[model samples]
Target: MNYTLHQLQVFLKISQTLSITRAAEELNLTQPAVSIQLRNLQDQFDIPLTEVIGRRLYLTDFGREIALAAEKVLNEAYAINHRTLAHKGLLYGKLKVSVVSTGKYVMPYFLTEFMRQHEGIELVMDVTNRQKVVDSVANNEVDFALVSILPPHLNVARLDLMPNKLYLVGAGPTGQLREEAEPELLKKLPLIYREAGSGTRQMMESFLAAHQIVVKKRLELTSNEAVKQALLAGLGYSVMPLIGLKSELLNNDLQILPMAGLPLQTVWMLIWPKDKQFSPVAQAYLAYIRDHKDAIVQQHFGWYERFL
Candidate 1:
């Protein structure tokens, strides 16, 4: 009936990945070591926690519940350690943030100096899709969430960090379309899209709908990198944030299409639930960002001003 915290951590990772090999790789443990830990953890529970079907591992319903509980336990344990450090007047803790996929490009630049200055602080940034990012915010799983589009239903406080400009971009040279081409010309070309719940996809749909322009949907990809790869392959055009395309644009591997109503605009914001309480690390981050965002933007993203 006695399971250690290490066992819980191992079980939680296994549940997340659903593969012993993958879990072992992530945890930097050997496969046999991970299996022994999992076995020991499973022995403490009477019911089945995981099962193997064919070649794949799957968590049982009971395993899923246990994993959630394990996460809560681990979070509290970490909180206690962080709290003790803070009481000692040290800026030490894990700073958790969930960012939309494309936001990875922006959030890291803002974080660099803060992280450098506070060497004791640890960062756990999850780069995920819009829906998951919003879910993390709603669940209060992270101190902040970085997004270009604000969730309409969430009552949250936000800090505007920088401008997020999206453009209809295609692969190869700039002469693909005339400067005065009608917006309706989009109908003739295929369009690559982010998955449905992505902020980029949502903005793309809203922009097209507003212009009453319906284009052909050629492909749907889950990550910005995948979408960019598709664009480079000449698969189709897509509405993409310029932050992620800076290198591509400079190299002339991609070009912005000329059309009216171009450069869909949104601001990058760091948002948290309005009612949530902050940790010492989170408060320090907020203060740092508030005081330094202007200077950080000027240093890191001043080139983006040309697109605005």
Candidate 2:
């Protein structure tokens, strides 16, 4: 059976998302276009690769197997192109990284110069919750994963990028509460939170549990931006990363509540599975990050040091 690389590419996206609409959106193709490609790819195989049940798409066992094969094929294809570019003294290929949601703020600063220099590189940065980022690393779906909290079970190598400082913050008009009154204040105030499986949420939970402080959970939001909006609307306070709150903090839109054990700290890390082979683009990224992380942090995040 013969299938074009584009068909395989389209099928791989479909397999990942399990939705024609989502695959189309991600691929920047029309839904009809995606469907046509999928149908064409399906025609090459006699057996069903996908099945629709209860209006939801599910890949057949054969589909899952083929998807894996398709990924290998695509990676090799990318490798071939990258190798040719490398011989011409240029880096080329896809650099896929999955980052925990709040990491979006940090990753871009590190990426800007590298991406600008390597114009031939294709960058795909997936911003999702901690669990998804971890899964991406575990499955080798991405070249690297950026996270604050490392998964204890995964055998991985990491490069520490910078400090991730989390503080309990609320809509501003700074209050003059003493450190001793902080826990009692938390008990009385409604707490906004990131959704479960978020690194921020995990850190917040652990902080509360350790201090034996139980907060009234007012709202749970999915993304950092959502949580920030909830804070701006004076909905509630949350433990938020300082990296994402620079403007808010400076403008007094949010105020960090100084508690006894305030500003819980973790290191932002670029992690990869220990045994995974790095692509040319991935290796170039690692090298660029290593050479420039210090300068990047000082340039982009120097204001952060004051909070520390």
Candidate 3:
């Protein structure tokens, strides 16, 4: 705990390189100074951080723990500095967003357009399922989240953009999945499904649950693309976000199933923690989305409607 930032840096460098002389050279500090800093840290902790097993220094468990923590501290400090520069009209920062997997299918172009305008801002995107995206926001792993199906959680705040309509898509002998089929026949095909914790999957289940309809044959996949692939190969069929398989639907690679119980709906949202002081980068994305709210809804919903 008595380690200064410089001391932690030295400790990390030495732990990584396992050579005191090399780490000191890398830090442009004399070997003696680096040794002194390390000794001070060890004395403060009352433990040996590095051990001389033979000729090399190896990080003990405590040393590794401190090194990992040091990296977080340094990265967050850099993020704070970037945020400060951005808020002063510098408009330079890394915008990190966690998104639902289906959203990754369509949101990149919008993000790219923004990146072009604010060339100084970098984009970091993590595409995952809805639960993971929410967890990222609540745990501060990402600055914000773009979610298509907002889960029921009290810790996060969501901005309701629009309701997302689900589609039951497949590749089975189809002009359209429902072209010649009636409702009872439509449910007979292999039902490819999103994995548990998928907001879309939950919505689909809930919709069917209302009618006491449960898909007897269910094949679960992690991502929308994986579901599409499985459907195309005739492994199974799935209910999916329309964004994921638009080209497939148009090109007849897949077909939308026409069933009375299909095409369930869930709300699309942008969510973040309710912290008082979110980073400038996070705040900027929120502000940008708020300002361009209409344009975003029009774009995605318009695309969703096109296939209908």
Candidate 4:
């Protein structure tokens, strides 16, 4: 009860990042300052909030509960601030977005245009993998999320954003592999795979399952860029989203292998919890992207056609 919202804010940031250093950097505060705020905040509680184990930081059970409560408090506070600005006829607020890694290719364009139109808006974007994005959605940690696969259990409002086409890509001459999309041929080739919990990896698994194929998992990469680099080095083939491969495809650093039932088509969706109230800025962005999806896609992604 003695803690200020500032303390809660700092604690929440630390909880989200699991790094006092990162939380301090994000909040534009010194590490000592952040530590002081955390110390002051924890003084009011009888139980320890967090623990450091083997150079890694973790929230205790009580810390996790308090972090969740802090999020709700901050969200409501922001909502009030939004209303106050609206009363003054001002468009000033923060927009928090959590996006899956592949969505990094598309979200910046949308956010750039939106921020350009509203100079007072603050944007906080987290580009994480699908699992983290899903956790954000589940925990109501972000205003919106951009992802390829929608979680079936969450009650959410989904707006279809754009098509996400995944291709089986590799380095080397285009015809080095057999022309046919045969399971036997693909199984023999070295495959570079995204780490587990990736939406792309899950989709690739389903695609391979449909074909009854099992590939040689030569490398497991943590990021799309890593996978792309491995492909360029001829380390292995991978199923990659076309959005992530536009430049490489154009430069002939990578080639999409010809195959039956390839280029698996999925749709990107913008989602927020159905029950959550949106701030004026969040509502405006939702409407703007919905209204301008085609133009946005054409403007940002028109180059895709020349390569396709």
lDDT by residue (82-157, candidate 1, tens digit) is 7886788779988999999999899999899999998779899888878899999998999999999989989999
Ranking by lDDT: 2, 1, 4, 3
TM-score: model 3 vs. ground truth: 0.66
Best model per TM-score: 1
lDDT by residue (tens digit), candidate 4, 1-308: 79989999999999999999999999999999999999999999999999999999999999999999999998888788877877878788879999999899989988788888886688999999888898898899999999998887899989987788888899855555547465556787888889998999998999899988867689999999999999999888988899899878888888888777888888888899999889888988898898888898889889866644
As for TM-score, the candidate ahead, 2 or 4, is: 2
Candidate 1 pairs with clashing backbones: none
Q: What TM-score goes with each of the models? A: 0.78, 0.75, 0.66, 0.74
Q: Give candidate 2's whole-model lDDT.
A: 0.90
CA lDDT of each candidate?
0.90, 0.90, 0.74, 0.88
The C-alpha stretches of model 4 lying farther than 4 A from their native spots are: 1-88, 178-180
Best-first order by TM-score: 1, 2, 4, 3
Better of 1 and 4 by lDDT: 1
Which ranges in model 2 have alpha carbons more than 4 Å from their true place? 1-87, 174-180
lDDT of 2 at 12: 100
In terms of lDDT, the best-performing candidate is 2
Q: For model 1, what is the alpha-carbon lDDT of residue 280?
A: 84
